[model samples]
Target chain A: MKISGAQGIIECLLEQGVDTVFGYPGGRILPLYDAIYEGKIRHILTVHEQGAIHAADGYARASGKVGVCIATSGPGATNLVTGLANAYLDSVPLVVITGQVSTDLIGADAFQEVDITGITMPITKHNFLVKDVATLPEIMRFAFRIASSGRPGPVLIDVPSDIQLDVFNFTQEEEQEKNKPRFQWELSQLGSSLIDRAAAVLETAKQPVMIVGGGVVSSGAYEQVVALAEKMNAPVVSTLMGLGSFSSEHPLFLGLTGMHGHKRANLAVHGADVVIAIGSRFNDRVTGNKFKYAEGKTLIHIDVDPAELDKNVSTHIPLAGDVKQLVTTLNERIKPFNPSPWWKVIWEWKQEFAVKPDGNDLSATWMLKQVAERTKGKPFIFATDVGQHQMWAAQNLHIETPRSWITSGGLGTMGFGLPAAIGAQIAMPTKRVIAIVGDGGMKMTGCELFTAASQGLPLITIIVDNSSLGMVRQLQQLFYKQRYSESLLPVPMDFVCFAKAFGIEGTLTTTQEEFLAAFSAAIESNCPRVIIVKIPTEQLVTPMLKPNSPLDTFMDI
Target chain B: MGHHTISILVLNQSGVLVRVAGMFSRRGFNIESLAVGTTHVPEYSRITAVMQGSDAIVAQVVKQLEKLVEVRAVEILPVNTAVVRDMAMIKVKAAQNKKLEVLQLAETFGAKVVDISNETLMVEITSGKTNTDALIDALSSYGILEMIRTGVVGLQRGDCSIYEKEKCEISALFDTAQVEA
Candidate 1:
């Protein structure tokens, strides 16, 4: 049947099992909004384009589906940049649709026209400018496929207004068949690349350490990761993205390894002779100094994206394929080994440098532990913004479920929590979604509270208000001889009042008991709630790797 | 760090070159010379990019290039076992007196004098980089006014093609049955 291009977009979305999308419409995208109104799909109108994009990212990460968002030309398109970069870095699959000026006016710098495809080229997995309505269906299909495929990322489709008004015949069944995966492309052949030798290396090593990254969750290799760790008798360390890929409570699991990673985990990695890094890109945050990182260790790196194999550090054995498949094959080939002696050293280090709150004061660490304890045994999800609180949560939160832990790992994006939590709550209506934000992070995208309240999402936003940019201050104190210039928030606006303005109940907690009570109440509430947990000014993420040092290096505590 | 020629097969489409070029600049790899054109299969295009980098950087260049959705295949051809060509047109400020010497020098390099005027002689050469550079050098003393090169394009020797063997497999001797198309 012949249909308008906007309706064809709807048809293509339905063909791909997408029943909902998050977006903010504008003048150039009126036709798309009209089609959305007539279509059966649910369209979430966020307060801002940034909120819409982040919500889609959160939806994708939480629901394991391709997240969709839309925006108009110029400012609407540019506002989605941070979210695009965030999704790109963290490998979240998002289909972003932007309305562009008419084809005749594209290069004329027409009103509200911007070169969105050019701007998003470096950040997105792939992007397209719909030259005509004829390719709309295929472009939409490929956009989703590319976004949701190997090493998933965000793909943008910039359709001109004229194309949205154009007519096209889009049959869902025929079009779907015609648009089957365009490429039989494999990043690398999953064979004897590093399997046999890597398994042998793990089995024979006296001190072997396995480091898991976000790839574990993406590949659904959690169970295999557990099995492999047990079979090799190697202690497992989780990257920021690999938080919930393995059970935090597992005896072999040493939580979060990186700059702000657990002290014992860093020591374990530094002392290991063999490092089996699975599904990790080894970003700078994880490697203190690339030259000094694992200098003598034999590195076995497995990642679905081959470009990331040796991008940061050289890999002794680069196994480029799906992490789940590679780890499963490695699991089958390897034999169990006894690491009693390794465990002895790990145990001593664990006892010597366990991750715990230093004092009894109401700190970020103290607040995070209380939040984690209050939400225990409940169907819960924790989404965090980047800051001291994020690091504290990574260091403290005990997550056991894959996809349960969602945060901006690679981009370390601020203002990601509120909209992300709203999206997660929408994706997982039955589960409790909580947003953990620092004062600084909350200030960046705090306006998203309007979205949560308007949608009536049961998202609990916990603002760990340190009254300062705590991480920046901590850094200055370490390097600048305690010259905490400009890092302090001299004018502290009342976050509780701000939350109340958004039609959400707000509470201020200064003590541990008060925080627990507020947190528990928020958990029970069906509507959005914001709790401001005031922490000490100097709260820091300790065991931070100093410049030009190894992972085990740190400043004087 | 040395230069390596990487040949890529990508779907003939707009914005594909920008994607490849963007990845190069984003990853800090330097493109010494690049030539792009359609292949015999009209649906696909070939991009011959010569990049300067270390072995690891070149490995990343090839790996990163293959990640593009439009890119079908990539291979780094060995320097010795390949036939490379660079097409250049150099316009030299030749007086009526020096035209024959420039012509004779260009003839030595198998160059054609495509255009001639009393003020200048335009010499064109399609050969390896060495021959093209030599022809330009021989005309430089005659006051070469302008010059342009079509970068460098190459194909592996013997029976193997980029589609049949990647990384310019020197041992692709047995795959003689598969045609280049």
Candidate 2:
């Protein structure tokens, strides 16, 4: 059947099982909006393009589906840059569609025209400028495939207005067949040898530590990770992105390992004879002072992407393949190994340097504990914006299931939590989604409260209002002799009032009891609610690695 | 740190060059020189980039470049087992006193005099990067006026071709391969 390009886009989306779209329309994209109105798709109009993209990212991370977002050309597309970068860094699968000027006016610098593909080149997984309506179907298909495939990330499609209005032939069956997965590369023969080498290393090691990264969750390798850890009797440490990949309550599970990671996790990594790092890029935060990170230990790195194999730390055995497959194969080939003595040493370290709150007062730590206790045994998802609050949440929150924890791990993006919560809530309507934000992070994208209220998302926004860029301030206090400067938010606008301005119920709580009460009330209300938990500037993420030090070289806490 | 020559195979599409260069600069890898052109297959292009970095840095650069969606494959051209060449055009101030010597020197390096004017002579050479540099240096005393090089392009010294291998093994190598019409 012959159909307009707009109809083709709608048909393709429905075929892909996409039910909701987060976007804001403009003049150049009017045809698409018209198609959306006539179609059965649910469209969400966000306060800004940035909010729309972040929400889509959150939705993708929470629901394990490719989240979709749309915007017009130029400024609208430009606004999605930060959100796109956030998704790219965290490896969230997203498909972003931006309207462009008519084909003839694309390069004439037409009104609201921007080379969005060029603008987002470095940040997106891939991007395309649709010059023909005939190619729309295939582009849309590949956009989703590329966004969700190995080491998923965001992909963009820039469509001109004329293309949306042009006519094209559509055949459902043929198109569906055309979009089937085209390639599945088997594990290279070399991979088998690499796995053998890894198993051999594990066999000889007295102390072997398994460091699970976000890839475990992305690949749904949690079960395999557990089996491997159990078989080897090695303690498991997770990266921030790997929070929920393994049960926090597991006996072998140590807390997050990195700059703000748990002391036991860091010490375990330090004393390990072999380090098996899976699905992690080993960023600077994870490997403090790269020269000393995993220095003497034999490193076994497994990832789907070969690029990540030797990008950071050199590997004694590089097993480049799907984490799930690689671990499963290792499970079959390896004999049972024991590390009881290693566990004893780790348990002692855990006791000697347990993560503890510094003060007895109502603090971020105290508030997180209250939230955790209140939300226990409930279907819940939590996201955090970058700051001291994020580290505190990472250090304190207990994630019970995979994909239950979401945060800006790679880009350290502020203003991510609230919008992300909106996306998560939209994806899983029955589950409770919460945003944990610092005063500074909330201020950056606080306007997203309008999006939540308008959508009636039933999300709970918890603002840890420290009235400063808490992380930077903490760093300056430790390194710059406490010469606090622009880090402080000089004029503290009432966050409760700010939330109220967006038509959401707001509460300001100072004590632990008050916070719990407000939090429970918000949960019960089943509507968008914002609770501002005021904290002092001295609140810090302790047991941190000092500047230019090794991962094991922590501050004198 | 030393200069490393890297080759990349990418889809022949718009903005791919910028994407490759953008990533290089974003990761703080300085590009010493870069040359790009279509390969035997019109659907793909080859980019040869020279950058100075440690072994780790070079490995990282190749790895990061490979992460780009348009890129199909990335490999570091080994210095010993590869053939490297550069094309350069140098215009020297060849007044009456030095015209013969400049011509002789250019001929010695297998350079052709492309253009000659009253005060200058333009010499073109397509040779190894080192040899091209040598010719330019030898003519520097003759008051070289201007010079432009096409940068370095390299290929392995073997019957095996990276492009052909990728064409056949793409389905067997990458998890996601673009289906050709």
Best by lDDT: 2
Error of 2 at A277 (Å): 1.1
* Clash pairs detected, candidate 2: none
lDDT of 2 by residue, A359-419 (tens): 6567998888777777777789999999898988888888878898999999989988888
DockQ of 1: 0.26
Alpha carbon lDDT at A61, candidate 2: 91
Please compute the TM-score of chain B alone for each predicted structure, in the order given. 0.88, 0.89
DockQ of each: 0.26, 0.32
Deviation (Å) of A240 in candidate 2 = 1.0
Off by over 4 Å in 1: A174-190, A356-358, B165-181
On residues A1-557, what C-alpha lDDT tens digit does candidate 1 reach at each position? 89999999888888889988999999888889999999679988898999999999999888999999999999999999999999999999999999999889989989999999999999998888999798888788778767876788999999999999998887675755556443343324445646888888887899999999999888788899899999888999989998888988899998888988998898899999999998889988887888888688999998888788888999888887667777888899888887889999999999888655557667777777777777676788999998888898998888878888989999988888878888898999999898999899888889989988888888988898988998888889888899999989979779889988998899999887888889878877889999998987976788788876898788776
For each candidate in the order shown, give its overall lDDT on alpha carbons: 0.86, 0.87
Model 1 TM-score, all chains together? 0.95
* Candidate 2: segments with Cα more than 4 A from true spot: A173-181, A355-360, A490-492, B1-3, B75-81, B167-181
TM-score of candidate 2 chain A against the true chain A: 0.97
Each prediction's total of clashing residue pairs, residues at least 3 apart in sequence or on different chains, is: 0, 0
Give TM-scores of chain A for all candidates. 0.97, 0.97
